[model samples]
Target chain A: MLRSLLEFSGINPLRLRMSWVSASEGKKFADVITEITKELQEIGPQQSYIREAV
Target chain B: MNVQKLKEEAARALGRKDVKYLIGYKKGSYGFRVSPAFIEPKEDIDQLIMSPLCNMSLVKYVMMEETLPGLTEQALKPSKIAIVARGCDSRAINLLIEEKGVPRDRLYIIGVSCQGVIDQRKIEARFPQVTEPAEVTEENGNYIITVQGQSHTVPKEELLAELCTVCRYPTPLIYDKLIGDKLAARPFHYDEIAAFEALPLEERLAYWQQQFSKCVRCYACRNVCPRWYSTICSLDSLSPQWLRRSADTSENFMFQIIRTFHLAGRCIGCGECERVCPMNLPLMKLNRKLEKDAKELFNYESGKDPKAKSLLTTFHTEDPQGFIL
Candidate 1:
């Protein structure tokens, strides 16, 4: 629903991704993270949507 | 609808022993404005009026009234309050009851069947500099507007509020006493949201970015929301994760988008936020998009079913997992 909201607001919904992996399955977690990171690289930073208040 | 009949009903509610006062629309001080009138028992109900110009949802006032616990200066709070409701306002009341904000028994609903309301800005723009008080009546797809002893006819489509154009419900869903004829509602439509969805992702972002940039961070949109009067409102917290007071794009987007999410399954599409917005933002776009998605994806429509649990409140094992991997 969060992803849907982001897309509705014109932000790339790809910025949000959720996955479920067992606690012991470190390999599966690492693989999922890498896949999301690749997708984020293509989608780029949500530059227009987010500017951290730093 | 007969104004006299509405006034008589208002008098009846005001005369109730438990009802503190009755709230209805009265003629505004100036042109094309309708003010919410609070009536006492002995007061004249003749002041009450309902026309296409009464464009706001009165449900917010019922919630805001609670914040004024001792408004009457009496030791005991008023047991019940009477309010005039349109179709959307009735929906809002039901949503409030579903959220347990206000008890249904504590309210005396005077539901008025609404055909549509006029957009004040649209009408004012169309007829600039009409300082005199104006009156409006709907007649056969046109508005018979009378101002300063001159009557003019304008097509309803030219001044009808945007949300009213696509309203699926024009008759109040709940009421102790109903006034006027029950109106036949238009079938559900989300053509605009569908078209917006077809646009490129970047284009959609650009469009909303421009709109959000125009936002001054005036909380009128927040303040006017019927579902916004919670004890622990999320965005105003001192926590770093919450939205700050600044009017930058990041903060504006955060405030508007996050607020929209909070109102996901509760918004009745009253168009109050968009109407009260100083920047004239298309605030309804975010709301209607979610409304469309909730209907299409979850088969849920807010304010349609009073007995059913709210969309966010209830969960099912069969809920869609397509978004998750």
Candidate 2:
């Protein structure tokens, strides 16, 4: 729902990625973060939704 | 349609030993304005009026009455509060009762089968510069609006509130006594949201950016929400200051996102927030988006059952987890 909202508001929904990580799953958290970072790098900076930039 | 029956019912409710007061709509001071009238005595029941213009939800006043101080321990006994409820207002009351926000035993809901209320702003814009008090009567799909000695007949659709346009429940879901003929529920449609969703992500963002930028941070949307009746909203708390007082687009976006998320699966599509917003923000779009998602994802429709637990409050082992990484 948050992703849909962000997408509707013109934000890159990929900028936000939710992963279920239990306290004991430190390796899983690291892997999730690394994957998100790679995706962000592929997507690059967010486009300006602010009117001034447009 | 029958003001006499409404008055009699209100008078009867007020006459009850347990009922403290009856909260309903009365005529406003000027054109197209209807104020919530509190009727204490049975004689004062004449002050109450029911019409398409009585769009403001009375459920908020019931919540406000609960939070007011100075009630003695003896006075705190579950006293009944009689409210004139439209379909949406009744739903709000049911949702409140379901969430334990208000006790059902202490409420006397006089439900009115609504034929949609007129949007006050739309009427004012159509008949501008009318200083005198106006009267609007719904007759056969037309609104006979009389202002400053001039009468204009306008199609109901032209001035009907947006919420009413797609209202699935026109009759109260739960009521002690219903007044007037019950209206059949309208078929729900999401074509508007679907069309918006069909647009490219950037375009959708740009559209919302313009709307969010117009926000002055008045918090009228939050104030008018029936579900957002928290005594101390986290957004307004000074200790944490979850939201700053800034009117910048980013801050406004954050505020809106938080507010909408909090209302997810709880909002009954009352559209009061969108109706009361000063910026004329398309808040219903955001709310309805969540509503649609909740329906599709969980088969949940809010405010329908008083006994059922809220969507976010309950979890199922068989719940869909495809969205989770």
Interface RMSD of each: 1.5, 2.6
Give per-residue lDDT, candidate 1, residue B60.
88
TM-score of candidate 1 chain B vs. the reference: 0.96
Give me the candidate number with maximum DockQ: 1
DockQ for all models: 0.71, 0.50
Positional deviation of residue B167's Cα in model 1 after best superposition, in angstroms: 0.7
Write the residue-wise lDDT of candidate 1 on B63-165 in tens digits. 9887665555363246788999999999998888887888888799999999899998999998788887799998999999998889999999999998998
CAPRI-wise, candidate 2 is: medium
Candidate 1 lDDT, A1-54, residue by residue in tens: 778878877777777888889999999999999999999889777677566566
Per candidate, native contacts kept equal: 0.75, 0.56
Return the top candidate by lDDT. Answer: 1
The deviation in Å at residue B150 for candidate 2 is 3.2
Q: What is the CAPRI rating of model 1's predicted complex?
A: medium
| Candidate 1 segments whose C-alpha is farther than 4 A from its true place | A50-54, B69-78
What digit string (tens of lDDT, one per residue) describes model 2 on residues A1-54? 777777777778788877889999999999999999999999987656332322
- The residue pairs in collision within model 1 are none
